[model samples]
Target chain A: MKIGYLGPKGTFTEEAAIKLKKFEKCKLLSFDSIVEVLDAVDKNKIDKGVVPIENSIEGSVGITLDLLAFEYNLCIYREIIIPINHCLITNKGVKLSDIEVICSHPHSLAQCRKFIEKLGLKIRSFQSTAAAAKFIKGKLNYAAIAPKRAAKLYNLHVIQENIQDYKNNFTRFIVVAKRDHEFTGDDKTSIVFSLEDKPGRLYEVLKEFAKRNINLTKIESRPLKLGLGRYIFFLDFEGHRKENKIVDVLDAVSKKTHFMKILGSYPISKIYESNSLKK
Target chain B: MKIGYLGPKGTFTEEAAIKLKKFEKCKLLSFDSIVEVLDAVDKNKIDKGVVPIENSIEGSVGITLDLLAFEYNLCIYREIIIPINHCLITNKGVKLSDIEVICSHPHSLAQCRKFIEKLGLKIRSFQSTAAAAKFIKGKLNYAAIAPKRAAKLYNLHVIQENIQDYKNNFTRFIVVAKRDHEFTGDDKTSIVFSLEDKPGRLYEVLKEFAKRNINLTKIESRPLKLGLGRYIFFLDFEGHRKENKIVDVLDAVSKKTHFMKILGSYPISKIYESNSLKK
Candidate 1:
């Protein structure tokens, strides 16, 4: 069961893909875009594909959500939450003061803004954290804020480890499989829906979840692109669609919502606790 | 007065600052980073600064929101909403088929992924939309997807216009000034706060706004970095705190919330409904 994911290698996605030891001896194929990863899964180019759905620092990956909305048949099989640790890496013997320009993925750089400001270095953005390490390897007098694995992969030296401005950083990744596997009974369903442009419409939808006592973990809206007043909501609730209550909630919600799609209800990851360690 | 914004002279911020000309004699200052714009505002380096707060296409500009929360004490004095119109551009005499590699700001590139894939070119990322336009000026083999203004500013010809996959694309920007101004009466307040991590904590805080019928425009959570489970919620609501009802709502929220800071409240920009066209 070979798997494809977003990568040029050494990205957090690659890390998450490798952790899936169930498919041992399976080849790992990396693609440049999340859409490509999804297409690969849809076409059976890869048995599974992994993409970051949310980050503790960045919130939901809008493209991932957009992809979910656009691609109708793909099912989410499993979810993985990976702890993100960023490091400041540079060419050997490069001192902080000697550096005038720092390059990294924008999110990584943002995570260490205070440290960069304290050092007074200019920042240049790269496409990915691993790509930043690659940029540093080809240049001198620059540092990259990236994962330590990136430093190792790109043959750079770590100037500082765990340089993320905040501790307990993590990114949530969802595994896209061709079809939904048997549920483990304890699973969460993720859905996206759009409400008509009217007051109390959204409240009424949420009222269903609340009245049923179905705990909602998240609710986010994106522009439906129709106009200023229109929006689509993405909701995550702690129950499997296979459950009777969830089925009723979806059935009622389907009638009220202008557009609704159940993205998937996969077995919750084994790691349920939010393990953010305080420094 | 000169208002510097994050831009290459023709990005959305540039467009918004130009639209603000009726309210003030505005000179546009383009900076590479929003933090730089914030720093300039803090040092009185510029009379005002406009930067993107959120985008319908890409979601929240997390770095901008983060800077508002932690690094700067600037107040939002005005708001500007710009409709996003992406165009594919290249040097004169260049055709789409002539391009082998494409470059743009990541979000821009991502927005135009469908078109780029249909054309089947390698897409590279640059720091900003304008920078990509500038880079393509001397490079014959690369084209860029950027805002319409960027193509005009950099003297590049548009290969294709309005190429975004979604028709309902818009970005909201805020004009930041050093001192807080009197509320416009018809205004909005933005604040960032953290709550003790637990299930339903977010729902409880949002309940405050929902109960008051305050109509929150946006609510997003960023890791607080205090620990793994903690989060800071950034909220945009319909009314200013200077109003008695809003003040009471805020007071009630502050008591129940662990940490809170009111970033600013000023007149929500009427830019969305204006007749002003991009010059």
Candidate 2:
């Protein structure tokens, strides 16, 4: 199967994509923009595409939500949550003090702001952490804050590791395919809907999920841009869409909401199991 | 009044602070981070502070919201919505086509994503758009995307002007101070609250605002992290908290909300004739 993700071969998204598949021969394709990655999956350019949905430290990835709203046909088929560990990587012979300016993705820089500020070096930003590490390997005066795996891939030396502001820093990525899947029997579903500009409508809709014992994993609201008095709600719940309880809950929600779109139902990701290599 | 904003010389936030006051000796102080700027105001280290709250293209500044949530003693006193125009800047004599990579703050880069993608050049992120312009002016083979004023400050050549993706791009900055000011009688108020996780509870709360004909300009949410089922809503309304209608609405809605906090109320920003000079 052909898979697409955001990458230049060593981004966290690439790592997550590779981890999602078990087959050795899965064809992996990289795209620069999230829209292109989604388009590739939609037009059958690729069978599925993996993109980041949210980051623990940074909150939700707004672009992903906006795209789901813009591209109405795509559905999420699976979910993966990757533990993120950022490190300070530098060229072979360089030390931390040798660096006058450090570079990395904007999110990474923000996550490690205190540590970087304590070191008194200027912060720079790159498109991705991997690209920053690659640049550090080529330039002696530069150091990069990136993942440990990226440091290894680019042969850069690690000056510090696991430097994020929060210990539970993680990014949730969802795999999207053109057609819907049968929930893997044990799955979760996501949907976006808008409440009429009326009182108690949101509480009533959310009550359906709570009463059914369906736990919500995420909820966010974005402006409809039609001016004031309009909003759209994106939600994630911990149950399969095909389940009777969930179906009934959604049906109840349909009555209360002005517009509702089911983004997808897919297998829920298990926590990552680190590799155990045998000598 | 003494005011704190960001500056070394020519930052956009500095320009905004200057426009906030008419007197030449308005006691302007430059700070480093959004937190620092806000803290100075909360601690009464300064009379007030001005910081960018939202941009037309980039949405809300997440850091500003986070700080506001923690510092309940401070309130939003005023707002300044500034028009933003980014230019492609490089050292003198460098042509646009000659640059292989472009750099800017992530928000700036994202705002111009479509245009940058059309140019088909790699995007690099930097500390800030102004800093990126400064770096590009001192280096080669690079162009920085930043406000036109930054290009002039750094002695860089503008290869292209008005390069943002959206023409109507504007950034709304809020002036924050210690408490709700005694209204000169025409002002705006901000509040944040959470609803009981019941359907129609939020709907009921919204109705109070609607019934009173209060125009809400913005509404945003953040995870309460109180675990599983809580959320906090940030809101901005057109009238001051002291207005009879607004006071009645707040009292009527207090029964429906689980928690409510008034962020403060102050005079709405008046039209500034000098803001037109930035272009």
Candidate 3:
């Protein structure tokens, strides 16, 4: 009945956590860092924890992926895909022309680069979006680039909405628990593996999935930490581990590589595709 | 002749530029940003510009790769690989025990996490390693985690050398020019392409290289900037583009992908592999 999220309360992760299934009866707690939230899940301190796995604009969240691959023993319970909409918020009664400076998290500022560049205002990076919103609560000339939820939470006036550089901007969040969700009939499985230092080894591994007609939703590589050119490949494919075809694909893949880990099986989010969020 | 680097001087790029072929005679000019340096090369303001393309621990530099692919018309002229060694530097006669804060660029600070955690000192992030070194010049009880070259340039004492968590750390720097180098007989080719988003499409493209006995030195994907799950693939292989077999591979690959670009060919660096850097 308890869930954890990366937060000082008003973050995208918190927004995703709020939308979890049957959240009306659950309690939510905020953790300062992603690792802390995941660690809490691993230790049973929180029933589940939510953290961002990837961004449409920024790509993968390297730290979250690294923790799941190497540091922690947890499986994804569910996924929540939401559109990342950044709005410019300021103190009440402040006109757009009155704003002399803007502030937000580095990622937010980067996401709204075009809008900020056009405004020709000095920008500063604060710790979080909500924190910035709170900092500019009583200030007339400063604005915060954050979400509409943050504006509501901080009692700020919304100056503009959806000011990000890209309209299709979205982030994929994963809920991690001690064990993965059971067969949902329609699910996605995530796995990570590394191959020997040889040519075509990756091609050989992909052949297993291709031959079985398995659709890989995502494919990425992270530095294996030994040196350059050495990577641990991460793949997300459609189908739960309980499925017969996936079992065969997993068996064939395990034999070809040196190391592999099954991160989880969870139901595909409704907003998994960028176009799905469109009206 | 003039060579440009990403710098205000006292940077790893500056060090790599100083060691560039016949560089003792070439005048060096420092640019404020990576794109500016590459833009200078593209505009013929500088003969060539040096920028970090990849790091053994951090993976690819996306901006450099993207600029070469879509924004600018430039090619790889040469590659310089050097070990990234961070040292704890302090103002003259300052002792390690007297240091209350450490400072460096965010990447450098992240690279030396274990060392910083052991010291248990407050940390600050600056614009660059050399900039941080300059900031602590006459301030007692302040130290900078920067390269040894920065220590020398800033007239600071090296309290300790090779203080990074990973000693095998190295960065790959590429020289960009208006035209790529002609065949050195032993050269490498780099290319980027985007697929049509179908199952087994990537596998089919890799088959072109595999069947032809082409050894892909590096393969990575960057977000195509359109949305998530869409990527532009980059490949580095062991032959110049003008080579017959590589030409055939490119011909075959061009048919498989919607778009492709040849980033260029240059002689492979001597320290391309981490193990080769061993004394």
What's the lDDT for residue A150 in model 3?
82
| Listed models, DockQ each | 0.38, 0.26, 0.52
My TM-score estimates for the predictions, one after another, are 0.88, 0.83, 0.89
Question: What's the lDDT for residue A122 in model 3?
Answer: 75
lDDT of 3 by residue, B1-279 (tens): 789999978877777777774434788899976878988987889998999998776667766887787789788988888888788999988887899989887667767876876788777766578888999988897899987778878888998988877766888899998889899889999999999989998999998988988888888887777777788889999999999998999999999998999889999887632222121
> In model 3, which runs have C-alpha deviations exceeding 4 angstroms?
A21-24, A89-102, A115-127, A131-144, A155-158, A272-279, B21-24, B90-102, B117-123, B135-143, B155-157, B272-279
Worst 10 residues of 2 chain B by lDDT: B270-279
> Per model, how much of the real contact set is kept?
0.27, 0.14, 0.48
User: On residues A1-279, what C-alpha lDDT tens digit does candidate 1 reach at each position?
Assistant: 788988978787877777675446678899987888998898877898999887776666788888888654788888887778777889988887778888887667777888888888888877688887898785778888877777778888888877777766787888898776466678889889987765456766777786788877666666676645466888888888888999999999998899898888987665433222210
Query: What TM-score does each prediction get for chain A alone?
Result: 0.92, 0.92, 0.93
Per residue, candidate 2 scores C-alpha lDDT tens digits across A195-214 of: 87764566667767766777
The residue-by-residue lDDT of candidate 2 on B188-240, one tens digit each, is 78888888775445556777877677776667776553432356778777787
| DockQ score, prediction 3 | 0.52
